[model samples]
Target: MEDGLLSLKWNNHKITFFEILRVLREKANYTDATIAVEGKFYPVHKLVMSTCSEYFSEIFERTPCKSPVIVLKDVRSQDMDALLDYMYLGEVNVNQNDLASLLKTAECLRIKGLAVPDEDPTKFRKGQSDDRRESPPPKRRRHEDSSSQPLSQRPVSPTISASSKTTPPSRTPPLQHQTSSLPVSQSQDSVHDSIVDPPPMVKVEMEEADDPDDGYSRRDNSYDGGSVNEGDGDFGTELSKSEHDPDNYGSGSFPGPSIQPGGDLPWDEGDSSSFPPEGFSGDLPAGQQPQGAEGLELGWLGGNEAFRCHLCTVSCGSSTQLQRHVMTHTGEKPFSCHYCSHRTARKYNLKIHLRDVHGVPIDRRFARY
Candidate 1:
């Protein structure tokens, strides 16, 4: 839907229906099949891609290569599950308020590289010369130092080693370095007053030291060779005992209803505060159990609400989608690939991706970026 609501007072400014229709009809974006999924149709009066999302259609059209399989051999199934989430929702929503690992399955799966700004190459790396960029050449140096120099005593062209009219001999003697240091009292106070170490010299070096460990902790630096908490005595015994102790009062009780501990059943939705115990016998109902236990019991919902990925023997939240994804490996070429860098998953998208990114001819329908 068009987010803009066109409004105006009739006597103040009345908009004609024809003008509205003209704007809707004449907009180049009204051309068919840009935003809608293929084999699906859209209303001519429907707002254009740009009317709602500026780059939506452009990103959709990008193309990649034609590798029929996505071999994420090294990735875990749980991470693959998250990637599957994007297939259905088009984006992943992650928890930000708590400490939970944001897991994205590393897909050697030739399906598609994430097509978004956060994943772009330029963003992943920063500019090389940003370090060398000079700060606005000290403001005081511009306004104070040069201007404050004594006008009467400053270097002048009239002071000559030899007069210009008398041409020196061809064999001129090499001039000695004769730049006499200016007296401290006569020196520009602004320069001397401002001369101090720049923060960047130290800051840049420190940043360079941290560059290697952005991804990995090669050595145990969290607890450096010395103690982690130097001043405080090591109360490892008490800290460990408290940190690992489970809150026993929070367990074995059901919410608003009597539930067999560890029993696999639906908890009463009416109340969810009191949860079951950790060592309790039966599988507790999901809601009445621990707050975080619900996600791990993931089931694949598929064709006829079946919860199994028959092709992969895996489970997904949506069975139909899972089925369709499995077909990608059968050389269906549902997404065309442009064979420049790597393969793309969808055929039509490859055309758009190639045109926008590589400036390549769209004739080869399989290319993807």
Candidate 2:
């Protein structure tokens, strides 16, 4: 128990350390060194890298350069990215396609715990074949076996045969037998008797009997069809229709609230109250402007702050702009020019390229600014 507890504690500490490293790498928090590979820079912590990799530690010790930028050669950017990811997360996704390159990179860096065992692929395939040969074939189902045989050859239970012989074969009774017991009324209303006596009386009694709330003699008021109150100017019909139709929940019609051109939304018109007064500059005299306005826009309490891009040194006024700028570094060009093979990172850039280079009119679909 003591040994198990110590093992558990050590495992927990290792997991916690990996989690801290992953967070630091993801957020680029307190990153002192940058690894430049294939024109892409990956920010990493020097202490973690030095402690984890002896090659990195030796390079840092031997080099006299003050800058923390280290350039890698021959190694693919994706493999280096995967290496860094494994170093931080303690686990990485490796497949047959990338396995060779990953192993080479790991061996070069002297990264521990990534050595592949010397096992032959043909031996594994032979073992699988031997196992398959030793396994027994699946047994056929009893029903299927019986179905494959002739009827005379198939076995039948004595009890089933006896029951089938005793039971009468099902057949539709003649109409004459059903009406023979009833006396035929020889009167002027004979047509009505023939039409109503056969099935209508039984159907009416069954429908009336199904209503448990009321007795069989009482009529169903809930049914709008064939009811005397149905002529009450379509109110019941409208109510029933509305209850059954899912689209007409509260009212029979669904109309969204009318939104006028520019005044319906608060954001449509810019809020002038949040901005400084007209012709008011920060460099002007303090007495010329409002008293509290100077420090209001300068301090952290003000909402005039901007989100800065961590990949590059560019700062943006909004998160959307910063995200668009980060995509340039990520090399994700989702928008492509329609006329030519030109592609751009932003939709607006694609539109501008199409208008200027391709001499094509910018359609409304690609006119996002």
| Predicted structure with the largest TM-score when compared to the true one | 2
Backbone clash total for model 2 is 0
User: Candidate 1, residues 1-369: lDDT per residue as tens digits?
Assistant: 287878755762323643454344334223322111111111122122222111222111211111111111112222223333222222332222100111111111111222111222211111222322221111111111123422111111001121112111221221211213212121112122222223222111101111121111112111001100010111111111222111110110111011222222211111010111111111122222232332212211222224332122233355334333332322222244444564444444567777777676875555221
Model 2, range 1-369, lDDT digits (tens) per residue?
Answer: 666654334658766876776776666777655554443446667676665454454334433332233433233455556567555654444333443455444433433333211121111111112312121111111121123322221011000000111111221111111122323222112223333333211110001111121111111111001001001122112122221111101110000000112221111111111011111111122232323221222222222224332221234576555444434433435567666677765677887888788776875344221
Q: Largest lDDT belongs to which candidate? A: 2
Clashing pairs in 2: none
Candidate 1 ranges with C-alpha deviation above 4 Å: 1-304, 307-320, 326-339, 360-364, 367-369
**What is the RMSD of candidate 1?**
36.5
Query: How does each model score on lDDT?
Result: 0.22, 0.32
